[model samples]
Target: MSVSEQFVGGDGVISTPIATGVGTGEKAEVIGHRTADAKPSGEYASILADTPLQADEAGVASRGMYSPLTSLCNEPRFATMRRGHKVMVGQNGWLERPGSIAKKPEQPKKAGFFDSLKRIAKEVADATEMKSSRRVKGGERGRASSRVRISLDPREQSLLYCELEFLLTSALDCYINSQFNAGRLDADKYKKVVDAWHQKGRPKVVGFRYDLETQLDLVFLHMKDFRFYGDRASVPAAISGILEAMRVNARALRVRTFCQPDSVMAKQLLDSQSLLNLLGSAEQRQIQLAEVVQFFKIVLEREHKLQRTEEVRGLPQ
Candidate 1:
């Protein structure tokens, strides 16, 4: 006889492309189901399709659970493509209604999107270790085989932006100044935040979602670079909202963000100088400076109210 026995059986104990090896054939391929119970399980199996291939009832159910066709889009408050823009909230259902047309603009719809994404991002902290897969757990690489998986979803970015907003409101000012990284968003702020994250501030999760971190860093960078809306008055509302969100952290926080008289035609329409030529109203930039100060006052008042509440909780009176 030879060093080993090799055979391939299709319907009967016949032959196929995999016949035999060379001299050192230390294995045997019993073409037929050598098991005592050779009856086929009712589960279907096809090489070309993802038909269930099972030898028992338990395996059949397991196949259905782990099938690639399983839907992960049944949750609510996740991202969905509505019209031309992405919608954020859909009742308790998170499934996408693809090909739906939008009648409005994305900017106007951003608030609702932001709210939904934030909720889901917070949900990421709860995902745990996934169960072992059949292929990696049964075949050559047994149960100890590690499974690595990565997915990039748009909702993660949206949720990250939510956290970034929250961080700006809650932690960035104190932390950034403490780390001495109060320039136009540099490594120092991230270093401080990451340290806090590892210590006690971060959420627990299943896997390291790199996209979330990347998106947060980009949002911070944009916030740091913002400077008076580049002297454009038409977009004053936009700049004002962002500025209200940002608080001065460092007494020595020195960053250059300048806006001159003649930057944009749209801005010129709102500038005091242009108004002087038109109606000779409040000159000497009083009108612009006054409005800016009023906006900041409102932000400061809201912040003070929050602090007052905090103080009251600590008092015995």
Candidate 2:
């Protein structure tokens, strides 16, 4: 018989039976398993194709093998879901919160030399502007104050001079009387009393012009002695009065200097006014009073001849 006719007879099989260990004639089907259907078309086809459940076409895949790979593509059931956000492997594991990653801290920016210079310059400019504005306001206030007239009439000036002279003589007399009553100045209190007396005397002598330089020198020495020993806390109101008197003297001297252009008295009064202002400023209060007064006296006693002029004559001139 021909080979095709022999193989094709009745049932479709080889003429001779093929050898088999598990089955003879036909292969056995496994329970609960079947050949997977050929992949579906359209969207279903694409999904199955993309899923890892589908093996490469070159390999044979079993129907029972779908559980592991297909699990990856499934939406997890709420009942079996885990409680944290999914993270990629090898990403930072530290968390700022239970569900979020910690962010990296940014570095502080460093300033350059030029940047520091710019900041300093801006600060200096702001301070200078502020100071200038303050100075302008002060000048305006000074001008406004100046408009209130201070009469320098001869009668008024003479009365002021006489009152100051009386105050000085009265203070000296009071101190002498206290000394007499205390039965000779106590040894420990002697220096204090003497200093008080000198302190009392300085303001009185400051406004006057001396006929001889010796008199001015003696008064300057007395001022130094008083400042050295005078108690600041117990500083009498008379000291404050003296300071005010010095201020008045400065203002009056300025006015007189302007009105009488050819007067030595005005020049002398100006020098005395400058010294008083130096000693009376708020800053001078903190310094060693003796040293401050000494410096003031030295400046005042500098050798300079007074011009001979009859205009703006002082008391007893």
Score every model by TM-score.
0.16, 0.19
Predictions in order: lDDT:
0.28, 0.28
Candidate 2 lDDT (Cα, 0 to 1): 0.28
Q: What lDDT, from 0 to 1, does candidate 1 have?
A: 0.28
The 10 consecutive residues of candidate 2 with the worst lDDT sum are 41-50
Off by over 4 Å in 1: 1-126, 130-135, 140-146, 151-155, 165-170, 174-317
Q: Give the per-residue lDDT of model 1 (tens digit) for 1-317.
A: 11011123233222112213533323233432222323322211111111221222232234322211112222322223245554465533345456654465556544453244333322221221221121362355543433322121233323322332332222222222222211222333333444445577444221112123332343344443422212333465544443332322111112212221111211212222222221112222222223222222232234334445766797421
Residue 310's lDDT within candidate 1 is: 67
Q: Tens digit of lDDT per residue, candidate 2, span 1-317?
A: 00000011122211121213323433212111112322211110000111122111111222212222123223342122348875544365343355555577898898763354334334433433332232223445545443222223343334333333232222233322222222231212333333454565632221111112222232233332233113331354544444454445434543533322112222233333333332322222112222222222222222111111321354211
CA RMSD of all predictions = 29.7, 53.7
Clashing pairs in 2: none
